[model samples]
Target chain A: MIWAVALSAGALVASGAYLALSRDALRAVVGVSLIGAGANLVVLSAGRLDAVMPAFVPEGASRLADGAANPLPQALVLTAIVIGFSLTCFALALVMTIRQRVGDTDSTGLRAAEPPAGADGLPAFPDDER
Target chain B: MNADLTSLVVVAPLLVPLAAAVASTVSAGRPRVQQAIGLGGAILLLGSALVLARAVAAAGQVRTALGGWDAPFAIEFVADGVGASLVVLAAVMGLTALLFQQDDTDPAPASPAFVPLVHAFLAGACGAFLTGDLFNLYVWFEVVLIASLGLLVLGKERRHLDGALTYFVLNVVGTLFVLVGVALVYAATGHLNYVAIAHATMADPYRVLPFVAVLSVGFLVKAGAFPLFAWLPATYHTLPAPALALFAALGTKVGVYALLRTGGAVFPTVAPLMSDLLGWVAVGTMVTGVLGAAYHWDIRRILAFHSISQVGYILLGIALGTPGGAQGALVFALHHSLVKGSLFLIAALVCREAGSYDLRHIGGLSSARPWLAALFLLQALSLVGIPPLSGFWAKFLVVRETLVLGHVVWAATALAVGALTLYSMLKIWLEAFWRAHPREDWQPPPGARPASAIAAAGLAAVTTAFGLWPEPVLRFTFMAATVLHTRP
Candidate 1:
């Protein structure tokens, strides 16, 4: 089971990396989302594969029994997933704004807005030209 | 046990700032209340850190196993000497950032949002330092990055957007690797606690390689090592004065502290080879960083690029893998946080007065604001490691340790880098302060002249105090070094 999960994660990361390198911003966002999911799953799986139940022991049961799962990773993954989701949402909004302003979402095509290397001081807003 | 009270030092750093962030948000339009809350939290955090520092100095170590669980099970907070010193640095930076926020008056009110974001960022930083678990460190890393992204986008500037995009992409990639590393470590060891993982890895050290690779990628990227630091110059240049000041102060030090904690405490044997690889990266980082600093005409961008180069020195000292080297690196890290943060704040004030950060447009402010100019000169001099300054002491420690370790070649290279750092600093001084100004129609806004004095005076006072009376900080730094280098 662990081996299968690990393979799935590897494949997910590879595909995500490919998508991240794509030209479109939306694809990059999706790629990040996928990567986040895969990472969470991988971390969750690291807590003892043979365990059949969550880490909570019933009253009168011995602590850290032979087959109970560790719940810390679950808690950690839940926190991480929330944080990752928020970051993705923010990143997506940013991408949307960039597209609206710049009129394109191609990652490669977004020209850096810096003036040429040796430009004089900050230029006045074009509207101020009049 | 009552030992849980020790967790207060660790928890307060995070909780107070978080509470302050929430408070600032609820009081949205009232900038004064936001500032007061933020400042109050920072002062309280500083007091907590000082108390912790004193406790650590007296006791050998202070341990707090969180959630009523013991170590290797519960999320632990350890306030060893090293962690205490970092907490102190965070507190100082927190205060300086608040000062910069108060003095700065950008067209867009950055203080309202900047206050909360800084609080969150500092909390994340302090969490990263104090946590004794690998996964908790990753959590803190995310917290820092999220807050940083918020600040990056808060002030709507075109260059900021551009820089933020690059920085965002690079940092996300770094975080991804850190996640991968944590998973790998967990899979191999079935433990997330620092001590348990350390023991597990020691039993089967070879199994740790994959995780180590992933973890190093995140930290190395965050530390602004070469080939991965292209984002820093552009991104940092785009941040507002207070945000940039905080970034300069504590953001990258998170990576330094992580590398130190993990390398020395968890995986000492493998550290030497890793440090060697890191040393080469440091060399590359310094060379490219200085070259980039020299190439830039804009004052802020120059400083931003120089930040990467200065981090290289800290990296080199860490890479030496000796007790003295680590101590020197710790001292350098502490000193750099103050010096760099102050310099960035000074640059912001210069831009405020001159109406631009571009050296080409601005000139001859020496006569106009002698006090600001003098402050700038002092900071600039200290950055270049002039004798009787904190920078000199830091540099001296690193160089001496390197020589003692017989890494003479790297030591020479570091000295050369220092010379180039001086050269770059002088270039900015000559161009921005001493160069003749063509009388432009622009005049500095009212009250812009004293801003640099405030920022510089704060830093200069600390640096001079430490430089002249090195006994206290030196002792603290030594204790910190021993905590990391000595085996339990």
Candidate 2:
């Protein structure tokens, strides 16, 4: 189970990295979303995989019996998922605005903020002509 | 059982900002109500921070285990001198940012979302400072990141959005690595609490090296250290004044603070192993950052690059991994927060008055507003560390400590960077203020200067007063260092 989780996460991250490196901003957002999901998987899998039982005790018992799963990582993953969802949503919204305003989702076309570095000594703005 | 009150105090700062964020949102349509809630929350944060600092100073560690679960099993918030000092300073910065935004003539009325976002940002910053759980810190970092992203984009244009995109991408990557680092550490030690991880890693150092190394990447990128910091210069110049000032004060410093907190407390045994490497990174960061600033012609971008280098100076002390070094780093961190923050606020004023951010397009400010020029000179020189200023003692302590450690190269690099920092400050002064106006038709954009100028002057006063009365600040930071080394 550990090996399976690890291999899957590795593949997810690999694909995510590839997508994230693209010039298109939407692809990059999708890439980060994948990476975040993989991170959640890694955290959840760390809480012990041998146990199939729920991380709870009998009604009158003091604690869970041996081989019961750990609940902590589940809680952590849930939190991560929520935060990740919000951030991904923010990125999507931002990209939509970029598409509307700049008319290009390709990062290569988004030099409005970072103009090409000027001549040897001085700096120049991409919007300097305006 | 006795810790309940202390715990409440510890969490008060966090709760206040959160409540403020919510309250301001509740009253979102009324700009006046939103401003009141935001400023009121900042004031309350200051109060809670003072109480926390005092409580933690008396009690070595003020620990609050959530849901009554103890250390290793429970999520916790721990406050000591270092974190408390940062909490207090965060409140101060938060208030200053609010004040900086309060001008009547400003074209854009305060975005209802802006004040609330600032509150949320503070909540995250304070949480990150106070939390003892490694995983919990990652959650707080996200809060800070997302809140700041919202604040950065509020009322911004297309050009600024481009800059914000770079910031978002890099910071998201940085936090992802931090999450991965947390998972790796948990897997290695089977613990998420900082103190527990420290015990586990310290006992079996070899098992944790790879994970700790992975974790340091998050710190390095967030700290805006060399080669990893292109995003900072690319993005920060596009921010409005209030956002820039807020980040200038506490944003990147959070990364430096994390390094200090974790290195000293959780991973002290392994910290020394990376000392030499960190020293080299420090040198590279300082030199490259200053050089980056030197090449910039704009007012804010130059200051942004200088921000990166100033962080390098703080990291140098942390890299030394000594008690004195930690002391120096803490002192420099606080001093730089005030000095750098005030300077950025001044840059905003200069940009407003000059009608442009470009240096060549704006000049003659020294003659027009001598008081502003003098204010700029004081903080700028303090940033460059002239004697009888806060920065002088900050640099003196760090460089002296490096010399004592017999790292002559690091010491020399520290001093040389100081000279270059001085040059950069002079460049801003000469181009933006000292020289004659480049065009006869130009004048400051027509508006009466706001009372927000008082906030900048207030920060300058604090820096100057700290410089003048060095003993108390020094004593406090030394105590902070002692707490960090002995406990963390």
Candidate 3:
């Protein structure tokens, strides 16, 4: 079970990285989301998965049972998932904005902040001609 | 201080900005009310920071476990001398940014969300500095990331979106790397608290090296170190000058601070192994950043690149893995934050008078606005490490530590970077102030406010004072270094 989880997480991250390196903005955003999911899985797996029991203290006990699952990684994964979700939402919204304003989704094409070099090789200041 | 009061003081640097963020958000549409709240919050934050600094000085470190949970389990906030000083720096930058923004009139429609986001950014920076738990640090980094992203896209311009996209993608990737690093560290040691992790890994420190490697990548990206800093220059120029100033001051320094806290303080055993690698990274960062600055004509881009180069100096100090090196890194971080921040604020004034951020399109400031010229020259010279200015002392400390450690090539690279830094500053000086305006009939803009100039001048004054009377600051940083170098 641990090997399966590890292999799946690795594959997710590898594919995510490849997609994230793509030129298309939308794909890159999806890639980010994929990578985030992979990370979340990795965090979840940090606590051993061998235990089948829930992380609970019995009615009379001061501590959780020996075979109970580790709860800390679950808590950490919960936090990472929420933060990662919001970040992906922001990235997607940004990609949408770029597509709307710049009229394309190509990351390379979004060069409004970095105008191409002019005749003298300096960045052509947009308002210079005015 | 009493225990309850001490706990409150320990958390105040974080809470003041957070409360301000909430209040500003509630008063969103009323820009005037929001600005007043923001200013009030900034002042209160500074007061809190000073108080915390005092408390930390009184006690070598002040710590509190939230919700009364004990150390290993509960999230902890600890302000040692290093963290306390950084909190103070954040407060100063927060106030300066607000003052710089006070009377500026930009043609772009100002976002009502700006003040709230600035406060959020401050809260995040303070939280990151104060937290003793590794996972908490990651959470604070996200807070900073989200707030800065909001600030970046406030203008809603195409350029703003462009820059924000690059920033978002790169920084989110870095954050994920950090998340993985945190998970791996926890798996290795079954601990998230710095002190706990240190104790857990003490027997076989090399067991934590792979996890630390992942963590350092995330931080290096945040610090805008070489080969991982494309996001910085690509995006920072898109910010309004005041926002740029705030980001310039606190953003990358947070990353450097994390490296110092973790490598220098928590995992001292691993420093020897990582020192050589970090030394080379510092050299690359210095050379790459200065070269990038040389290739840029836009004042903001030039300053952004220089920010990276200066981070190299601080990293070199950390890479030395000694108490003296930590001291140098702390002083340089504080000095660079003030000087570089003021330089950006001054650049904003230059833009106001000369009508462009591109140096080629703007000039003649030396003749028209001599005071601004003087301010620019003061900061520019200080940035280049001229004597009796803060930058000189900062560079001296770091380079001295490098030589002491016998890293001759690294020390040489640092000195050479300082020379190239001078070249960049001179480029700004000669082009923006010395040459005539590109437009023959250009005139200084009307109704230009003195508030921004006053803010810049205030920073310049602090830098000058720090240089002239370096004893107190040096002593404080020395204490900080000793505290950091000593294991908890």
Candidate 1 regions with alpha-carbon error over 4 angstroms: A48-50, A54-59, A112-114, A119-130, B1-4, B104-107, B440-452
- C-alpha local distance difference test of each model: 0.78, 0.84, 0.88
Candidate number that wins on TM-score, 1 or 3 = 3
TM-score (chain A only) for the predictions, listed in order:
0.82, 0.87, 0.87
Residue A111 in model 2: shift from native, Å? Answer: 1.0
lDDT of 3 by residue, B77-124 (tens): 999999999999999999998887788533335568988999999999
Better of 2 and 3 by DockQ: 3
Report the Cα interface RMSD of each model, rounded to 1 decimal.
4.2, 5.3, 4.3
Could you tell me the lDDT of residue B196 within candidate 2? Answer: 88
Best TM-score goes to which candidate?
3
Off by over 4 Å in 2: A116-130, B104-109, B445-447
- The residue ranges of model 3 lying beyond 4 angstroms of the native Cα positions read A118-130, B105-108
With a 3 Å backbone cut-off (N, CA, C), the pairs that clash in candidate 3 are none
Alpha-carbon shift of residue A114 in model 3 (angstroms): 1.2
RMSD of each: 2.7, 2.7, 2.1
